[model samples]
Target: MNLAVFPRRGYVKDPTPIESCPAFSKALGGKVNIFIKRDDLLPGCAGGNKTRKLDFCMADALAKGADTIITCGAVQSNHCRLTLSWAVKEGLDCHLVLEERVKGSYKPEASGNNFLFKLMGVKSITVVPGGSNMMGEMEALAARLKEAGRTPYIIPGGASNPIGATGYVSCAQETLQQLFDMGLKVDHMVVPSGSAGTHAGIVVGMVGNNANIPVSGINVSRTKADQEALVRKLARETAQRVGMSGEFPDEAVTCFDGYVGPGYSLPTESMVEAVRLLAQTEGILLDPVYSGKAMAGLVDLVRSGYFAEGSNVLFLHTGGSPALYAYLDTFK
Candidate 1:
């Protein structure tokens, strides 16, 4: 498929890299080689995976002559931080609807992304109770902007739509090139599955590029069946956007929900261990909610002999390390 036909919106650079995670490897007893695709290092606002989606989403916004950007996410959303970052960079106003998916988690005095949101110059923020209709909230925000005579563009959470997912498809292509250059072969790749864009886009990109490596999602929320369905739906839509033919096999989109403990953003014992291990071993910080849980799953899967001994596994470090601060007590 010719993805070039889609507007890149000024993010036309090659992807970061698939680098060896020596620290994380040693923590796992070196049972399997661990490498990371550092999407977390992608440029923008202390960096995170959402930058990839914003590359395309911002392009669409600019194309539509939007002067303001509106989006929604959980209170400590990395996506929200990055959205505001990009909006600042593009000279557009940014507004956010903070969802308290976990009741009482939305404190006006909270740290982490909330602090960053203010520092990043978000024009406004509206806090909604958990389970509020996000689309309705966004529409309301847009309507308010219209009343003020501003041209506003709405980007869905995590930019999970096809346009946002193209970031991951592009990321997959970049990963393949990096692997080739490094003379490495990745047998499997694991990533956090939340909004589903990263998982879906990577699936589409790998399939389009004929890279047969399986992409496994460690669910940060939702179940295996539900997450898989959401990912497949997004992947197919992304594939169609890029003009790729054929369907993504149902079995290809896989997720493991065994790791989501208690609920989203709630710390688990495994999550704490995973976070500390990565930080101490590799000096790489992972947020408690997403990447920490994902690493926990990856470690367990490796220990269970899911991958052959010495198999090279790539983990996409989607980045939310800042949120770690909010959960300081958990680790302490």
Candidate 2:
């Protein structure tokens, strides 16, 4: 695939790595060898998976000669945090539309990404009710910017569009190369499925490369049925963008929604334990919302013998550790 034909500004040439997690592997009782692709270490301000998407999204914005960026996400969103980070790097103004997916979570003085947003010098913020039309809200922001004489670009939430997802397609290719070098064959890969870009892109990359390894998504929000449909749709779109042939079969999009307790970003007992386990045993930190719940699901599945003995399970560590600081009270 001619992935280089796609625009990629403000992007690092290489992905992070698929490294051995001795701490986590030991914690799982050696039933399944656990490895992590440290996407959290991707070079960016505070770093996270969103950096990959923004590499493509921001590239397109720059190509279009935009001076300002507008995007939407839940309050304390890692995607928003990374978006503002990239905006600062590219010297573009950023405006955010915060969705209160959980009511009363949008405190202006809140810590974590909220504090970072201000520190990064975001131009403006619009707080929207949960489930509002995000596209409309972002367009309104762009119109307001234009009225003020700023050329604005709208990047969709999570940057889950096909172009943005190309980042992960590249990631999939990188992972396959890493596996070959390390002599590690991944039986199953697990990742947190929130906005679907990472999940979708990985699916396309794996399918296109004929890797044949299944990628399972642990949904942080939405039901299994709802999340799978979204993932499959995005995967197909992403595959088409990269000029990959064939449809991603519906059966390939697997998700377990059992870990999303209460609602999005609301912590669950399993999530809490998962975070603690990673911290204490693996010395790795997982955020409250996405990776923590996904790890919980991964742990349960491993214990349930979902994979045969000696199977190597790969976990895509799409980072959000900064969000952990905001939930100090929950952790305490």
What lDDT score goes with residue 17 in model 2? 74
lDDT (C-alpha, whole model) for all candidates: 0.90, 0.89
lDDT of 2: 0.89
| Per-prediction TM-score | 0.98, 0.98
Question: Can you write out model 2's per-residue Cα lDDT over 71-131, one digit (the tens) per residue?
Answer: 9899999999999999998899999999998878899998999999999999998999998
What TM-score should be assigned to candidate 1? 0.98
Report lDDT (Cα) of residue 239, candidate 1. 89
Scored against the true structure, residue 232 in model 2 reaches a CA lDDT of 92
Full-model lDDT, candidate 1: 0.90
